[model samples]
Target chain A: MTDLIERPSTEAVPGHGAPTHGDDDHAHGGDHEHHGPSGILKWLTSTDHKVIGINYTVTSIVMMVIGGAFAEVIRAQLVSPTNTLVTFQQYNQLFTMHGSVMIYLFVGPFAFAGLANYLVPLQVGAPDMAFPRLNALSYWLYLSGSITMLLGFFVTGGPAAFGWVGYAPLTSAINAPGAGPDLWIGALMLTGFSAIFSGVNLIATIFYLRAPGMTLFRMPIFTWNMLVTGILILLAFPVLTAGLVMLYCDRHFGTHIFEVQGGGVPLLWQHIFWFWGHPEVYILALPFFGMVTEVIPTFSRKPLFGYKGMVFATLTIAALSLGVWAHHMFTTGAVLLPFFSIMSLLIAVPTGIKIFNWIGTMWGGNLVFSTAMLMAIGFVVTFLIGGITGIYLASPPLDFFTHDTYFVIAHFHSVVMALTLGAFAGIYFWFPKITGKMLHEGWGKAQFWLLFIGTQVFTVPLYIVGLHGMPRRMAVYPNNPSWQNLNEWSSVGALMIGISTLLFVVNVIQAYRKPIPAGDNPWDASTLEWFTSSPPPHHNFVSLPPIRSERPVWDYNHPDAPALAHGHHETATPPAAPAEQEAHA
Target chain B: MKQESVILLLLGVFFGFIGVVYWGWGHEDGGGIMLLGAFLLGMLPGFYYLWWYRKSGGNRPEDRDDATVADGAGVVDAFPSTSIWPFVLGSGCFFIVLALTFGTWLLVPGVGLLLSALIGATAESRRGGNV
Candidate 1:
């Protein structure tokens, strides 16, 4: 059978799905190097997007464990009244590295690199990523950047404790001097470059690539989300790279880019950082948005609700997310409250559309409560709460009370942590397809519940303590009876979140230990990705299948519907009729 | 012969234009910009020709000319048997990551992997006498 499959002349295979000009125009175009070794060699040297995707997932999981450990240490220190478990310096380092690692090292890269690596080419109907060698380089650069930043901890004076934002003066050599911030800046600069190059590659691929009849309008929601995400990276990362360069200059050289004593503007740093930082927020979340599009449609057993609107909303969010960066600096006292407030509130308009669309998608559908769906739903609820509190933070009046408090922590953590959960949800959902094996479902679900409850318990009370004038990044609250109880509750919640993380780890290990065979289209997804074998071939498709709609695989697998008018049809039978009938009926 | 080289040439021209704009800004430290510009100017037409042959509706024989693959090179499509360059590159990456994190000792292995891969690739490709 395999030989029969391989017997077709290469000329017979249709190439990229560009609008077929004539009979002779559709011969296969791409030529890639194929290598051997079924086991370790495949993983070690493979340029296949699927292999690269697994590498991303494995690396991200490792970082998450490391990030979560940092969280636990922070929680343990905060559990009791005035517990000097860790020194003040140590506590500062913990939260700062925790924030930086989780944001840059874990969520940001994992969301884009992991899902985009696996899904972008499949969604766009390409054989593989546009630049396969470049794709490998992105992964390597990311791993390199992550390791460099982490290595800062082992260096003298520990990692930069100036918070992930690395606010000036605090990060400046005059106030807090060390090799720590240098490592942080250098690592981020490297990671930023990785993201920029990958973004360029993805953008060029999606635009120039795609199978025939796969019009922009007909593209899947996940692909659209990534398209917008790629644009965001191009625009946002350069500003960050510039900012990092200026920062490097200030730190290493005697440049006064942000040096207060040297007549440098601290707020300039804020402008540049947040310009990238705010978009960084969406860069982190948009992939989750993309994943939600995938999960919600599959679990709800419907095509995405308002697909075009969701795409528009995603772009809107990406654009608006850029303008609202200053809202993060409301506490900095130099920002214009009215302008930032308006922009921040305006963001909710597009965001509201997204929430409604997700809910609309699930409404009156089968609504399978898989680990993926739970996480998507979790994203909506958590992000909604995060968004609402964000509006409060946007207001100068409300922010005056909550500024630098645990309230701010609760707000951002809700959004970013929700992103982490959503990413994990995607990893679990797609793990079977990518690995050609099933992750332990029982462990997966248990992990989900733990994180859900843990997030609520741990982060919600930070709001209360925040309102009671308790600041963030504080090692110990000195004799504040009012703050003690809520802090303890938060600690307990943190512990649960930690346990949930362990469950996920256990699930990953167990699944790898005895891999379950997941056949092609395990979820019965309608998109083109599911049409191929589990862990798709290095060159994605063999014969370019005829795609008439967004859901080509579904169209093909359905038995009832007539085949679309496409030349170079390989299979004699119309295999898609049954699924089409079932869907319509 | 491949599309990538042509694309790179086109990129060179476009980037050269950018270098021109930077040079016009009269920044004295524009040597880097001008050098990049010179490189790009030298590469444009060659790239344009290559892209025309591969992608554009070109006047060429069907069999002898490069035949464009379908949307994806569909399932079971054959190509050159796998090469070891990617693994060598991966090894280079592992060492680079280690060197970044641990110390300079790891840099030696990374450089070694990279050089060996480069040399090995160059030698093997030359065996086909393509280069």
Candidate 2:
């Protein structure tokens, strides 16, 4: 069964995708090895995708550390029910900044600006993103936007403490008067444009820049997910910017957008926020879904069991996500409960399909259980729980009971933890590709276990407490035996997550110190990225591999790799040279 | 008939049907209209991609079902080597954000930096970026 893909054929033909550019079309195209500008200046001004990717990764790592530090401090304050390690205001600031930093600054940049930046171009066999300079601009804007949001801390009023959601009236001038909210608004606008532009750049790159035969179907699932994610970002982020603008006006210009006294409905804020907010959840998860999809198939030594299904699931998820934002607002009495609850429940169908798809990919195959695969499998186990809780919460009846409770906390955090696991999988899977150095497998597995265990430890207790009527975002809880005990337990889990992250950092250091040179295609994987050297050069591929299937590298290696040979119905050869065309004429 | 349209158009029809259902049954709600908006959002892009998927007629070689590794071979584009405009642009954006804090006075430098960055970028693009 493992040796089936070895049928043989040498065929060069254009099928349906690549547009012909007349006679001798392939003879003159823009192919240049633009490896220029070294040193800090190279980083500062470079339009290279690799450099921009590194910029995003390094910055996200820094933000993650800062964000994680905030979480640790929050946990310390929660260690005892009566603990006041921070003032109430300070705790709000800590949690607000932590959530903001992680969501807007860390996870997004890590996944898109970082991982997608590094991989998508290579995966699609493109030289670089379609708009190189715009891509660089996005990085700069994102970097500066990240700084702007953090600058809220230095302001006179302290950081924005109305929660990362920044629900209005609470954020209005009367209730919350501060430059910190203003700064948060400004940072969001900046980052919003950064995200919007990044979305545009990525979508264009995927559409326009594929190598000659890399058809839509043949493109890797990772690239397909990026394309879908790009569309979601393009559609969703602008609403956030619009919402932020309105919030700013309500604060500074004395507008009545969210001010109930001015005949403005404050619930408008929830509507606008969640409209983007729910889709934002998918934006966060989809790329990690792509990453785990890639990792599982590679380690399992199988083509993704339902490749097209995964792609369709991604699109279906994106579309359904847009309609389900009101699920977040079910208890507000402002939304159509039946419509939203149904949409929310409907979304789970596609999401559930993806779960089955991943499982099927690994079912009968030789599984490697590498750290990357471990994290992918970890994602399958963990996110399934998260998804189930989602169904429970989607019902308006249940949500009315659980609104703002730790159940809410457990539900979202479970999803976030699962995605975090997926992200770690991606980082480990591609670290070798990015740095050309293999992280120690032993340490990688250790990190995965700590995170996986820590996630369960931290979130499982929250579920129990949540079901038992514990609340979220609380600075102080009455010293009840049940709540305090569980809260103490969860803080220990948070510490474990912190330790796992530290282990990851140490793993990187050890890899660099010992220097395990990961050759091109370290996993014997089957994508175009592996076709080039680890840490691919200024130009990604030096030579061509006939991209007849999704697993081009595998096909290239095995020539007639089984049923793949029979599938090559491509009959139209590439456009002839002018001389050959004249001869034919 | 394209795969993207199948998924996207299905979404559009769902939203459209739900929008109509919502408006008919839940007339006083903003969500009914929003569902209509969702239908538009889904269909407009859905139709556009479907149209382009049809119109472009030629996809990148990778779009083909049977395309081989050789079919994808080509000279790649010359990616830009360096551009100072991003720094200029970022700085301009920074000033713009600062203006929100300090007052309208900061917009002077911000707008100026932005305009210059725009000019520099336009010039750089026109020069083919080798300069």
Candidate 3:
């Protein structure tokens, strides 16, 4: 059978045709070079994709801590309807910074830029990103942008109290007369540039850097999702960047782009922001969908039920995401209600297709309920609730009622929370692969349950209170004594989430303390990533098996029954088994 | 690739049909136009990839199963040995933003540093033989 597989060409593959460099050769060393930079300088100056990825991941985690702290402050303020924890102004800053930090700094960077950076190359069987230095530049810019945004805290009038959206009239020089909004504008512009660079790099890498036989159709679902995500960033972030420039000009040069009194429409800001904002939701989401896609197949021990369907569904979602932006403006009255409403509802079809495909993948398969799988399943349940409620808000009439209420808050949290859950799942699933050590499964499972319960406890009440007409971003509300109970419950849930996060930290610490080496393929997975060692070598794969299908390793392990056996052309002569190849060397 | 393109083309048509419903209902607003635009955009990749696949002999390295990792191994991507342009560029940007609040004096150095950094980064990559 091996000889049959090797009957094609004896010549080396065209793409992987370069001579192997000595391990110590810095000039052309493989990714797993024995001698590389060490210490802080190594992290700061390195262009290695893996190093940059770790930097991004660590930086985003720190930002999450900062953002979560702000959430706690907001929760504390709202615990008792009358402001006790913070003054009204402080409360405004708290919520505004919380939203901004979470959206811009934490989730977007963590998933698309950070996790994608680490795994995409390994999964695609590439050495590094197309532009490694630019990759480093993106991370630095992200870090600087995050710091610049947070610098607003030290300014005279607190950080951009007009909220994360920073609507024009409210954010005007006269309305928000401080350096804070300027800082917000500057921070956004910087981060926007960083995202654009990262997007371009990822798109280029995915398009040009696949291994010998990995084609567009054969790429992992996670890599495909990131590819779409990179496109979204390329298209969407620039609009926001333009908006930020306009906002800055309005604040300084007296430009009237969004100033209604100056003949600039305030709704212009809404149009611009949500144009980016709606797609931004998917920018944070599509990766989660991809992560879940990867997790579902592995744990269920089945080939992904509909690979082509999943890919098309992802593309469909991306294309329609642009059209559904105005659905967010349904209650604004200026938006064309019927048109936006229909588009909003229509976007759900692709999403629904994805959900069904996941269930289909799991149906009647041997399910391994790892912590990662548990979180993936949790995402399905929570995201479904979020999606169903979203349909309610898609209706103009319903939106008018629920607009600016806790119900909207609940709905947004449900979806973003689902994405966050999915990020955790990806982190857990790949932790061993990245670190060469398995996480404490018992603690990981405990963390999942806590977070799962905590999220429901935290946000579900926001729905109840929102339906009861409790407005969002309010420091205190009068004539709503009954709202206090739900608020307290929500705060408790927030605390639980915090605890769950701490447990995750504990799990990481414990895993690292007593490192048990995870071999090359601990999970017996199917992808190219598992074909290499845990924490893959500098140049990712030393040798790869025949890429017969999407599941290369699976094909290698089960040579008799390859996945998708149609049109199995022999591109190159099969090499010895990975272990055998190493032994021969 | 051809089959995947077909799937996307059909999905595009389905979305296009949804857009027609909106258009025929006399709802010719931005929302209706956007729906149509989305469906049209969705069909583009389908058309392009289909064309490329057919033109380029409908088969790619990914289509085969007999290649090994050694077949995939080669020169890992070229990376800069070391460079300071990122820091330079980042500092320039930081100062430029800071100059927004502090003083215009910072802008001159910021722009100067930015230009130098851009040139240096490009030159460094070329010099390092990575590009």
Best by DockQ: 2
Give me the displacement of residue A533 in model 1, in angstroms: 0.9
DockQ ranking, high to low: 2, 3, 1
lDDT of 2 at A463: 91
Which candidate would rank higher by TM-score, 1 or 3? 3
DockQ of 3: 0.26
lDDT by residue for model 2 over A366-468, one digit each (tens)?
7777888899999989999999999999999999999998998888888988988999899888888888888887888899999999999999989988998
Q: Write the per-residue lDDT of candidate 3 for residues A1-585, one digit (tens) a residue.
A: 000011112222323423232223322324345355578777766776787888898899899989999998888778887867898888888888999999999999998889899989888876677777778789878988899899999989878898888876899899898888888888888888999999888877887677667777788999999988987786578778988888888888978989887898788788788878998999999989999999888877778878888888898888677766778777767766777787788878989999998998888767778888999999999999899999999888899999999999999999988988998889888887889887877888888999999999999999999999998989998747679989989999898888889999998898789876766766657787887777876656555556757887766665555346433322222222333112212
Best-matching candidate per TM-score: 2
Candidate 2 residue runs with Cα over 4 Å from true position: A1-35, A565-585, B1-15, B28-38, B45-60, B66-78, B129-131
Instruction: State the lDDT at A411 in candidate 2.
Output: 84
How many clashing pairs does model 3 include?
A: 14
In candidate 3, stretches whose alpha carbon ends up further than 4 angstroms from where it belongs are A1-34, A560-562, A565-585, B1-77
For each candidate, what is the lDDT?
A: 0.70, 0.80, 0.78
Q: What is the DockQ of candidate 1?
A: 0.10
